[model samples]
Target chain A: MADANAETDLKQTPLHDLHVELGARMVPFAGYSMPVQYKAGIMAEHLHTRSKAGLFDVSHMGQAFLIGPDHETTARALEALTPSSFVELGLGRQRYSVLLNEEGGIIDDLMVTRPVSEEDDGKLMLVVNAARKDIDYAHFRDRLPENVSLQVVEDRALIAVQGPEAVAAVAAHAPKAAELAFMSAASMEFDGIDCHIARAGYTGEDGVEMSVPAGAAEAVARALLADDRVQPIGLGARDSLRLEAGLCLYGHDIDETTSPVEGAITFCMQKRRREEGGFPGDERIQAELKNGPGRVRVGLRLDGKAPAREGAEIALPDGPVIGTVTSGGFAPTVGAPIAMGYLPVEYAGTGTALELIVRGRRLPATVADMPFVPNRYYRKPKS
Target chain B: MTTYYSKDHEWISVEGDIATIGITSYAQEQLGDVVYVELPEAGRNLSQGDEAAVVESVKAASEVYAPIDGEVVEANGVLADEPAKVNADPEGGAWFLKMKVGNSGQLSDLMDQAAYKAYVETL
Candidate 1:
C-alpha cells in the first residue's frame, strides 16, 4: 500500500511503530494509520488467519463503561436502546447488538459485555465502531437513564487475536485466558497491567479480544506477535477475511438504511426482547419476524472468473435488476469469486439463478447460504 | 527479443511484428492476490493505451492498458481460473495476451526494464 502522508492527517494506533518495523505497508483506515498487510501480502495474511492465527490492532474502536445502581437498572437502561436481553445475560458474557434509529435502520453494531463479578454492579462495557463511535456515544448519552453514567475509556486499546490457533497462542502468554469461553470476558493481568480479555472476534474464528491500557497496548501486541503463529494483519485482509466468513460490515452490508431483520441479524435480539416490544423499530422487526422481510441478505457464487463487486446490479432471468451486491471478493480459501447481496425473499433461496451485470456483460450467478466459510464459535456446552 | 513497459505497468515482449503482453512485477505487487482477469478476445483490434483487460484483487479492481496498436492473436485462458499465477510469475507464465503489432514505431515510446524500474521507484 502506498503512503499518502500529504493527503489527510490521521491518528496513529499504538501499534503504528510496530507495524512499520514489521515491514507493513501502512495506509489510512478509519482515521487511523493502520497496516493493510505485511511483506507477506493480503492473500497470504487472509489464508494464514484461516489456518493459523492473525493479530489485528483494532484499538481504533471506542470503548466505554455504563454504570447504574444495579443489574436490573443497567439492563433496563441498555434494553431501552438495543434489542437484547441484557438482564438474562450471565455475568462475564458478551452479546452482539445493534444501535438502531427510530425507523429500525441500524446505526451501528456493537459489543456489550457484563463483568463477571457482582462487585461491579450496574456496570457494563461497550465497544463500538471507530468511525461512528462519537455519534454513538452522544446518542447513548442523550437516551440513557438519568441515573446511568456513560464514561468513555479513551485510555484503553482493543486488540483481536483470531483464528484456529488463537486460543493456544494467547494462552501461551496469559495462561488464565485459556478458561474463557466464547463471548465471555473478565478483567485480567497482562504484562503487569490490568486489562479486560473477552472471548470474541469478527472473523468467525475462535479468538480473544484484549482491551489493554493504551500505554501497555504496544507491549501486549508485541508479545502476541512475537509468537511464530501470530502475524499482524491490515484492513485489506480484514475486509476479505470478514467477507469470507459472511460477516456484515456496518457501513457496507448493514447501514443506516438497512434494518437488522432484513440484514439477517435478527439473531442478536433475544426472545424476551422480541416479545416485550420496547426497542426502537419494534413494530418493523416484529412484522418482519412474523411475515418475513421483503428483501433478505444472501450470498452469491459467480459462475465465472469475473468478480461481482459492491453496487453491481443483480438481474433476474429476464434481465431485470433485482438487487445489488453489497460485498464481493475472491475468497482466498474458497479459491473463487464470492459475494453477498440483498434479493427479494422469493429469490433468496439457495441455487436460485441470477446474473451480475459487470461492465455491460451478464455474468451468471446463483444464491448460496451464508458463512461461505463455516463459523467456529467456542460456545459453552449445551445442557 | 526486447521488453518495454507502459506507465500503467503493462510490459510487452517484442520480437519482429509480434508482441506478448503481461503486467510488470510492480503492477502485480500493487494489485495483490489477483483473483480474476478479464482479457480482451482474440481478433479484437486495439489502439495504443486502450483499456484491454481488467484485473481484480481482493481489495480493488484495476484496468490493464494496451501498450501499442495491434490485433489480439491470443488471450491467456489460464488466468481465467488461476489468476494467482499473475502474482506467482507475473513476467513468465501469467502473460495476458499476444498481439500482431500494426505499428513497429510504437516500441520507441515505451520504457525498458531499467527505465521502468526507475519510474516505479518514483511512485
Candidate 2:
C-alpha cells in the first residue's frame, strides 16, 4: 500500500505507463512506483511464469561498472571489499557476491559480471539492490583503490524474461543471447538495439536479463510482450518465485546485521579467499566459517495453510522464542505456506520440530531444506 | 430483509434481529486468493467496528470489522478447510459469522447496495 507521502515521493520506471495500460496495480517499492501484480493476479502470474514465461521490469535495480586499467587491477580492488574470487572470473561469466560492512555484515548481495568482448576489457559490470545502491556506491567510492572507479549506469533499463519458455521467447529477437550458457552474458542487438543480455535472473528458471537504453525500453518491452507466451509479471510474483527458489531478499532475509555465512550463502565465498582473508570484516567471517555462526538462516515450512509472514516469532514446541521469520508467504508453486528465519545452528537441521507464533496461536512448523520448490535453471551440457 | 455495506468492504444482511456478515465480491477480488481465515467464536459479543475476523491472502492479511453491535450466533466453519470459498463465493457460503443484532439502528451508518457500488467507484 502506497501512503500519501509514498505516492508523492516515489519515482517511476521506464515502463510505468505500459504497466498502467496493462491494468497493473502499482505499489511503492524501493523508492519506485512498481507494479505488484497485473490483471492476472499474483497466483495466476506465479503459475504462468512457472508453466510458461513472464517478463519483469527490474530497472529499479542499480547497474554500474568498475573501470580500471585491466581486469587484474579491477578484480583485486573489488576482492579487497568482498570475500569472493573475482580475479579468476572468466570473461562472459557472472558470480553472486555480497558487499560486507566493516563488521562483516552483508551490506548487500550483488551480481558481478565480466563482459565477453575485448572492447569491454577492464570493466566488471555490477547489479545491486535498488534500496542499497546508494550505500554501496558510497562505500565503493570511499574504499576503492585510486586506480579503480565506479561508474553507475543510470540511462539503462533492466528487463528479465524468465521461466520454462523464457529462452524461446527471448530467442525470437536475440538468437545470440539464447546461445550463451547459464550464468554467462553477451552484448547483443535486438532489432538493431544494442543491449547487454545475461543468461541469468532471480527466479529459479531459465531466463535472460537485458539491459537496454532507457529511451528504447518501451519499444523493447512491447516487442517482447508481442509474443503470446510472455506476460508482464509484478513484484509480488517475483518475490514468491525467489522465495520458492530459496534465494534471499536483501533487506529481509539478509541485511546489514547478518554476515554471508550467517545468511547461509557461503557459496559466494571460495576456499582460497576464505583462507587468505583480505576483505572487510574478514576476522568475523573467517571465525564464523570455522566455528559456525550462533544463529544460521534456515527454511521453515508450516504444517498448515496459515502463512507466517515476516516478524512472526519462531520458537521450540511449547518452548521459548528462538528467532523470527524474515521472509514468508503462501508459496504458489509449493501450494503451501513457507518461510525462512534464523535459528541456532543445532536447531537448523532439516526436519527439526519448530513452532511459529503467528498472531496469538503457535502453529506447528519444521526446519525444511531450502528451495521449497526445485529450481529449473538451465545447465549447460558437456561435449 | 436488507443488505448493508461498510467502508471496510464487509457486507451485512439482516432479517429481523439476525444478521449475517461476509466480505463482498469486490473485497475478494482485491484480496486475490484467500489462503486462511480466522473467525470469532460463537457467543462472542462484538461492538460496531470491532475486529471480528481475519482474512489472509497470499501477500497480506486484512481484518474484517463487525458492521454493527451484535452477539455472535454461529461461525462459518466450512471456511476452515476451504478458504478459497471466500474468493469463490465471498458473500455466500463464505460468510464469516451470523450474529443476533444488539442494535439495528446502527445499520443506518452503512451504505445501501446502490450507494456502496457508487462509493467503490470513487476509490
Candidate 2 has a DockQ of: 0.62
How do the residues A139-212 of candidate 2 rate in per-residue lDDT, one tens digit apiece?
Answer: 99999999999999999999999999998888888889778899999999998899899998988999999999
Model 2 residue A206 lDDT?
Answer: 92
lDDT by residue (A283-311, candidate 1, tens digit) is 99889888999999999998887788899
Taking the candidates in order, what DockQ does each have? 0.62, 0.62
Q: List runs of model 1 lying over 4 Å from the truth.
A: A1-8, A381-383, B103-106
lDDT of 1 at A285: 86
Chain A only: TM-score of every candidate?
0.96, 0.98
Please report the candidate that would top lDDT against the real structure: 2
Docking class of 1: medium
What TM-scores do the predictions have? 0.95, 0.98
Score chain B of each candidate by TM-score: 0.97, 0.98
Which lDDT tens digits does candidate 2 get at residues B1-123? 899999989999999899999999999999988889999999999999898999999889899999899999999999989999999999889999999999998999999999999988887
CAPRI accuracy category, model 2: medium
